[model samples]
Target chain A: MIKITEKPIDVQKVIDTASSLNAGAVNVFIGTVRSKAHGKNVVWLEYESYESMTVAEIRKIIDEASHRWPLLGWAVSHRIGTLKPGEVSVVVAVSSPHRKESFEACQYIIDEVKTKAQIWKKKYLKTGRNGFQQAHK
Target chain B: MKLKIKTFGITRDILGGRLVEIEISQPTVSLLRSELTRRYPDLENLNSLFVAVNNKYADESEELSSTDEIALIPPVSGG
Candidate 1:
């Protein structure tokens, strides 16, 4: 499953979808909003995306990763709109017959999603200003 | 040709809105960028800016049409 949504992501759903009898290992990566950015206190975070393009790009990344790994299943989901600190922002789950392949594929998916996906984040600072900066820069 | 461009993040603030319509004589990605930077000079301050046409990242050399969907993609910050 691949989706961009306004609601909080269900991490368990992602893991369940990627779980299968053929898989011995299931790797999950969860991204959360940091309480501080650049040493400044963060009040909250707002996420936005070109929805159609974001979903399309994620699908492409999954396809590429699947080609390079012997995967059983995988799921990627992102949350948009307002999110407070400690909230989950994104989740990536991958299952494979071997532990190494699942771990590698899960890492690759999140890294690619960070760079290639069209999602953007805005940081609401406790200083009463909103800072919009690219993530993973 | 007339083009509708979608903006996000700081680009929306720089453009002063989520969408902007611009009229151009030449229909190419590079020409559009030049026109945009000419009007909104602050856009040049960004570390990187990308143009997407019809939901795909487009090259500056690619030709554009009036009906195409164009979006200004600033450096992405997603995970």
Candidate 2:
């Protein structure tokens, strides 16, 4: 499953979708909005995406990871719109026959999503200024 | 050809709007970048900028048609 939503991410749903009886291990990664950025206090974050492209890019990342690892199932979801600190922004779940592959694939998915997805985040600072910056830089 | 470009993130602030239309003699990603930077000098200050042609990250050599969906993608910050 792959989704981009404005609603709070249903973390359990992703895990459920990725869990399979055939898989011996499942790994999940959750990314959240933080209250500080580059030493500045952040009030909130606003996420936006080139909706269609973002989804396509995420699907591509998943496909690439699946080819690199032995996977049984996977699910990824990203949230958009204004979110407060500590709010979930993204979730990636991967199930594999072994724990090693699941962990590696899960990390690979998030890394690819951060760099390749057509999604952006705007930081609202407490100093009365707000700006957008590239993630994972 | 006239092309409508969608802007996001800092590009939106620099362009002062979400969308802008420009007339270009040639329809290509590189020409569009030249036209955009020519119009908005501040855009050059961005660390990086990418152009998407019809929802896919496009290369400079990619040719664009008038009806194609074009967007300016600044450095992404998605998690």
Candidate 3:
């Protein structure tokens, strides 16, 4: 289940998908609007994807991550559009026969998505009259 | 051939939520960017933006086909 959308991600739905794979253990990672980064409050985040390209790349990323590790199954979903503080921005669910693989692979999935994938990020810093800035590509 | 590129985030705001199509005999990322930046002066700071073709992250060297979907992804907020 590789999904990127503007709606708030349904964590349970994705977890249910991973659990249906019949793996013994499932590890999940949910990234929320953090309170502070660089000493600034994160007001909100506006996620932007390159539309179709982003979806294709996200599926590719999941495939690549799954191939690189020993796992029964995994799913990654990202939320686009305007996301306020405390909303889920990203979610990764991994299921495996053992705890070790599920834990390791889940972490790796997030790390790879951050660097290897073509997705970019804009941080909405909280300051008087301040809006947003491109964190990186 | 002409390729339409969708803009998102800041790019969309700059472009006023409209699609940009540029005519190109041979559409490469570099050429497309140069041509697009020229036509859309509002997107001047978007030179560094990533271009997506047909919803797959595309490299600058990729050739553009008429049916391919293109977009300008300004930045993401995924953690």
lDDT of 1 by residue, A1-137 (tens): 99899998989999999888999999999999989987777777889999999989999999999999999999999999999999999999999999999999999999999998999988876654655443323
Worst 10 residues of 3 chain A by lDDT: A128-137
Candidate 3 lDDT, B1-79, residue by residue in tens: 8888777656766666658667898889888977877877766765457777776568889998888778876644345
Model 3 residue B2 CA deviation (Å) reads 4.7
Q: Where in model 1 is the C-alpha error above 4 Å?
A: A128-137
Q: Once superposed on the true structure, which residue ranges of model 2 sit more than 4 Å away at CA?
A: A128-137
Question: Which is the better candidate, 2 or 3, if ranked by DockQ?
Answer: 2
Q: In candidate 3, which residue pairs get closer than 3 Å at backbone N, Cα or C atoms, i.e. clash?
A: A52-B55, A53-B55, A53-B56, A120-B76, A121-B76
TM-score of 2: 0.92
Model 2, position A75, has a per-residue lDDT of 98
TM-score for each model: 0.94, 0.92, 0.74
Ranking by DockQ: 1, 2, 3
lDDT of 2 by residue, A23-137 (tens): 9999999999888987777778889999998888888898899899989999999999999999999999999999999999999999999988988888876654555443322
Model 1 lDDT per residue over B1-79, tens place? 9999999878998999998999998689999999999999999999999999999889989999989999999989987
Q: Would you list the clashing residue pairs of candidate 2?
A: none
